[model samples]
Target: MRRGAKRLLLGLAAALLLSATAAAGYGWMVYRQAERAAARMYEPLAPAEPPLAYAAIPQPTRVIEAGGGLGTAGSGQSESAGRAAEPVSGPFAFASEARAQPSPEEGDPFTVLMMGVDERAHDRGRSDTMIVLGVNPARGSMLMFNIPRDTRTELVGRGTLDKINHAYAFGGVEMAVRTVERFVGERIDYYVKVNMEGFAELIDLLGGVRVDNPFAFDFEGYHYAAGEIELTGEAALMYARMRWDDPRGDLGRNARQRELLQRLLQRLVSLETLGRTGELLDAAGDHVRTNLTFASMRGLALDYGARLRDVQTTELAGRGRTIDGIWYYEVTREERDRVRRLLADQLR
Candidate 1:
């Protein structure tokens, strides 16, 4: 063979190899992007999370001896305050008590209560905020709506409504879950409750999130415009709570809140955060609490590889009404019905 022909052949071989490598790299990038998106969509229970009646809760519900079950009793009370022996149903305040009789539907789709509590050193303050999320894979939609804390009605355990958030503080986790179930007339398959402390940390971990301000406003010395900007966790938290600056008040905060959640999911599933899975999980485990076990979370997380679509958020309407000289957000019958129907459609 001629020397020129040999050189030409070698050049052709190199070009072909480079083309193959480039194609593979592009494909890998696409796969990774999709994988992250799916992970974000999976609001799964943790491996430690048990069904409503199964797992143990965090607090020592009642004091007892070694080898004694929850119902067992000694000098049932905490050592310090001598707080009357808590009913022997919870430690972590598992949803067990709420599941004395389980929901009619066993999460064929899935139901979750996204709760944010105000926690101080010595006291687990009330569930200051509550957002219920009902997701249906079949319908490919999600429903989220809020229940104001002060709205009085029938409480779950005591069957009297004082403040919705008080349920958790009064009876712990199980009580809060049950109270929500009774209020919505829906069974809660799982819950994720976290304190606001780690909110800022998670945002910084995900490289911050982007949000749009409908109108420009000054908040806590930070000015937000009606455009996109990267937000730190503290900024985002502050943004979500800035109802005073927003003309629309809580409704505006609610919109921003949902926007924050959606973007967080998107960023969570992006390639930028792939190598940081352990860190993300650690942040979540420390900040967020849920009954979903490791096994359940894995299974749910695996399901993320399937589809990427915009999540659906329900728009809830209610009037702030005062009863007995106190104020509460009261959902009208029509609005309540609409939420139920929307939830059912998504769950189906």
Candidate 2:
């Protein structure tokens, strides 16, 4: 009623509004800062080889070895160790069968299928590179064992035995995932497949990866001197793709793949990657795919990095052989059993 009284009331209201506005702005700032902190603390997770990228469908025929005896599965173990021993449940049972969610919320291993495809830009190709990785953050260890793309195995969702890589070619990621699951007798939780183009960008992003020159001679204007050398993106691609020049053939190529991976790992771990977070996420979003939620990767990178401060490298034991005019890597039963146990324990 009084003009002076009305003016006083308006002043009080303005003070309250300003206080609330200040509080809200402060809260928003805190949230953004926290997200950035988490992002900065992370290292790129072990790259998911694209083998698991296409698990959305089922294969027509899948490899199932009856009584070949996969693992020495013991009782009273974790689900990962358990999944390592069971048979693939096929596409119909995917979500229910493959528990892609991380239960521990922290320090649980992020399992991914790593696929290296033999195709170039303007060409779509299936993965010729196949490897199963079981990374246990709890154990602070990363383990990868390759599956010979030509391993003689039955393909699930299909009619008969075919080269393992054929599963991806015929059915894409879904068939590829199913085929790998049957071979190792383990449930693949996720995948990140990168081809020649993506590989080149990634190598360049990291400013290049340093690899051990296990072979000599030149290819495509590059000479890989024996021992250790730093490789740029194009050079790294040529370097990683060279197998014919090596004494071991595909075996040498396989070794080179592992080396390329190791160089990435070493580079990722050695740097302060906070500034590159945007570029990193862009690379993963464009070149990588999986059942993994962004939250899941963020959790694993921070949680696992905290627990496992170290990583070790390994390869599968197999002989290169030709079957029906196709080259295949034949892994003996003993090798399967050993890798199974090793991976299971780390994953646990």
Question: Compared to the true structure, candidate 2 yields what TM-score?
Answer: 0.67
lDDT of each: 0.52, 0.51
lDDT of 1 by residue, 1-348 (tens): 111111111111111111212222235653344334334433444222332321111122344444864432222322233422232222223322344422312223677777777676889767766777775544445566666655554455584535677888887677787777655656677776665555566557667778776777877777877787777756666677676667776666666666665565555445576555545544444445556443344333334312324377765676454334455554444565577667656565
The weakest ten consecutive residues by lDDT in model 2 span: 1-10
After the best TM-score superposition of candidate 2, give how far the Cα of residue 140 lies from its true spot, in angstroms.
0.7
**Residue 196 lDDT in candidate 2:** 36
Residue range 1-348, candidate 2, lDDT tens digits: 111111111111111111212222235553344344334333343423323222222112222234763432122222221132222333222221333455434666656676655454555566676767777766677776667566756576784555787887777777777777656656676665544335455446556667778657798788889888987766766665566677877666666666555545544544344444344444544444444443554455444444444555566676554333445455555565577567666666
Alpha-carbon RMSD to native, per candidate: 17.8, 18.0
